[model samples]
Target: MINYISDHLKNNPLLVLDGAMATELEKHDIDTDSELWSAIALINNPEAIKEVHESYFKAGAKVATTNTYQANVEKFQQFGLNEAEAKKLIIKAVQLAQAAKAEFKADDLLVAGSIGPYGAYLADGSEYRGDYDLTITEFMDFHRQRMQLLNQANVDLFAFETQPNFEETKALAKLLKTEFPQKTAWMSFSIKDSQTLCDGTPLNEAVKYFNDDQQIAAIGVNCTKLENIEDTIVNIKKVTNKPIVVYPNNGDIYDPKTKTWQANPKTSSFKELVPKWIDAGASLIGGCCRTTPADIKEIAEFT
Candidate 1:
């Protein structure tokens, strides 16, 4: 199944991943500001989640990332769920995305189980800063159970996204290689700049770390500045031969104090940047924060 998606990427010039799941859910009156973000909607309003996936498909997205970005056991326990129940919700996230894929009935559409950063669970915007303090073993333990359940739930692939540091990325990659070697995953970093990850690791260094990892099918940037994405991809291409995946934010600066995104007047239009990202060798393209289906629709037409 992993090869199925990879083969498509290998044969097609571009594969369109879905835009922001949380932002699209907001249009359905779903609250995405809590610690769980869109994962909260998975419990309170799963239908809305499914609707957002279907909408993305209609907008020409070939991949639907699950709403499990924050649906791990620790966060659910905070919301009064036991370990068993938490695992169910985590698996449910995959089920919801799978249901949407079935309803859409597109053979090419794939479901990517979302694995967000540990800082996302902190709800402090630290995912963009990489201030967490966990050893590789601890990081593996944190992600192991969720990865197991999502793999069992039968997602087409894993999207280990928005990672801020090399440590956690290496941890997760090792976990996948050791425990679920048959599964394919993509690792996307949150960049502080075109040349560095959010934790200040040089982008080329990070890419080199995963360049020969068999479990990682692709490597690139996500939830980064629009202007920085092209340069980031160019830098990554210099280090790895893996297919590149890029899904940048909508050119808004995030304020951790208020947990809001301040719009940037100079934000580039999605239509304008899509071609540049493609020109930079991104095999997969999509949006991150504040992006909508309309943005994806434009990409579908452009590509």
Candidate 2:
């Protein structure tokens, strides 16, 4: 199936929908500092992760991301695991997602192994700084271990998502081409206000950097407000004709006062937003933080 998807992408690229973050999955446990962290809370509770997958499957998601975005060395270090232990945890995360995918007989569903940035922020705390703290070689070495596990799991694709800086993205592109070249890699940037990536680099420059790497199957934005998605995609199209993907965070900026995401996502209802994304040339659409199966269902209905 992975081979089939790879061929399909090589020929006729199609709209790819990513799975929503499992915020609800975090409800199963309250261990904020565990190696598993809030994201991997679903690992111990298999049924919870399975349920989330099933919801997205039913909602019409063609691609489901494994719940492993934060299972990397840096994130685990927040909980005290060394690099080796963190790598193993990443492998375990892939296994758990595979099991969930199997239970649903989601043979046709694409399971993208979620690979996020190496560190929470690019070295300079601005756009990805490849040279800020380490060279491209160092970034390659760091990702090599996890990419190996994702490849072995036979996941449908590799998503190098939520990057804020360009330098880190450059390193990621180089690493993907050299290591997991067989897997289709989708890169999405997280943006701030009218300016650039989360790290302040212009989005256009970021796109151009990724464009040089043929390993990137698709590119676009995620983890931002819906209001910003339209402009983000429009700017992206100017740089490249490759397929675009957008999965905005639900409209509400979290209100720490209430500890909840703002209830009304202003961009549009989930149903309305799908068409907007498609109209804006988004070949892929899904939800990011604060989104749920309901939102995905709306997207699936359109695609």
Candidate 1: lDDT of 216?
89
TM-score against truth, every candidate: 0.96, 0.83
lDDT of 1: 0.87
lDDT of 2 by residue, 22-95 (tens): 56565544343343434555335656666677667767777778777665666665656677776666666667
- Clash count for candidate 2 is 5
Alpha-carbon shift of residue 265 in model 1 (angstroms): 4.5
Q: Give the alpha carbon lDDT tens digit for every residue of 1-303 in model 1.
A: 355457887668888989988887888888888888889886788888888888888898899998888789989899888889888988888888888889977788899989998888788889989988899999999899889999999988899999997899999999998898788898999888999888988889999999888778889989987888888888888888889999998888887789888878987888998888888889889989888989899888865
Off by over 4 Å in 2: 1-16, 27-36, 73-86, 121-133, 255-260, 265-267
Q: Report, for every candidate in turn, its global Cα lDDT versus the true structure.
A: 0.87, 0.68
